[model samples]
Target: MLFTQAVRQFLEHLQAVDRSKETVKGYKAELGYFNHYLSVKHNGPVYLEDIQLEDMEAYMQHLKERKKSTATRNRVVYVLRSFYGYAVKRELCKKNHAELLEPVAIIQKERDFITEEELEILISHIHQPVIRTVIQTMFYTGGRITEMKNLKIKDVDLENEVIHIIEGKGKKNRDIPIGKTLHPILTNYFENIRDHENIETDYFFAIPKSGSISANYVNRLLKEAVDELGWNKHITAHVLRHSFGTNLLDKGASLVSIQKLLGHANLTVTSRYLHQDKDKLAEAVNLL
Candidate 1:
């Protein structure tokens, strides 16, 4: 019934459920911070049953006073709710105190995307053959950086012109079509860089030196490319995905098709990438 016991159980449950390393670490860090706050405030350990609405309110206030962003505060509250839910379900607590707590309001900010012209310029400047191919694939497929990085040779069905996404976010698998424009580049990469290598693994992007490139390495390369191009816009691998979705929507692709291509479970999640122009929205309304 002690806080430490509950924390340990929560972590054990998370591991049992096969949670991602990042997710588990985040939950542990957030809950550990909450436990530390209770200990410091009360001069002793606080049990799950000892938690009150005031304690929750104080935690929210503490986060706010520390100038945590709305998004971060919301995430912390979410973690608390999940932990308390676990406790309640296991009969460790009579009720879920954290469940009733409200998250801070988060304003949905529009994401910045590169224009088609800017993308052309950026791609033109990237000299590395493999890096250029990877960047192009991201733009064309709207695949996450990890999805692309973790891609295997078998995942690409060149004859079918489709790329298989295995174990994407939320453990979902889907296939997206590869554009004809990228086929030649992909074929060349495979024939030149991949064919000669004695790779025992199936990963498509494995380098001769490192085997596989880390997400940090991809981001660093993207940063260097962005700097070399002297573009003021914030660019990352995710931006390439956003650009693909936006481009599709601009070309009048339906939300349903885009959702499937992006492997978004919910249409609402894919709606974020629709990014309709104000002028287009107005024009459609006028026709209506």
Candidate 2:
């Protein structure tokens, strides 16, 4: 079967299995990019069976030539692995060269997350109720902006103090605890803003007539707050999430609790946020 056609089948399977919309869209775009590169490299469409290790190596080199970041190149290669795995399952390909491709190490920099005090400052500065609540939710819940965008009114449990994250990253469902600060912020938003808007849609957050609140808009809102506070950092919704884990770690919360709170599949991923604090480094040096 044609390689591009196989990609379509794989993406459809992702949708059928109820993968997150961003995952489906991102994987589709990445695969499409690879398909274009492979077609150009081979001077035409290459069949699934025609794929070889050399082709995979050349594609990696092509990504480097294009000045793609290590993380971006890794994602493209990972998508290729998923694609070929699907092809192999359907008997369209004999082997998965994408998996056999050498690993590319990503040098992930530590993201600057807001301090608890800064979060309070940010919330205090955001006069807009919807936007304030959105920041509060990210700080309190550690949810991705996409997860917040996908949230429905029904997902919030006010009485129980839980936010049900239905199908977060890795297709995992988790319930994050509602913080004392966020509970009041959310209550006010619902009572004053969200209810007054009378939006017919089930989505918890949206602009009037614009449908759901977009990730781009949320980023802009954060950028404004960061600028107003004179914070010399690029903080996004995910950075707020990083803050959530780091804050908890600072407060003597166990890594196991944080792993569960962030819905990380393993402890290693959760451990990344623990060592960035200067206090933690100082304490470690004194142990000698």
lDDT of 1 by residue, 65-107 (tens): 9999998999988998899899989999897888778878878
lDDT of 1: 0.84
Provide the TM-score for each candidate, comma-separated.
0.86, 0.91
Clashing residue pair totals per candidate (backbone < 3 A)? 0, 0
**Over 4 Å off, model 1:** 2-4, 18-22, 33-47, 127-129, 194-200
How would you encode candidate 2's per-residue C-alpha lDDT over 10-123 as one tens digit per residue?
989999988878899999999888788889988999787887889888988988998989988888878888888888888878888888887689777877887878888887
Off by over 4 Å in 2: 124-128, 195-198
> What lDDT does each candidate get?
0.84, 0.84
- Candidate 2: worst 10 consecutive residues by lDDT? 191-200
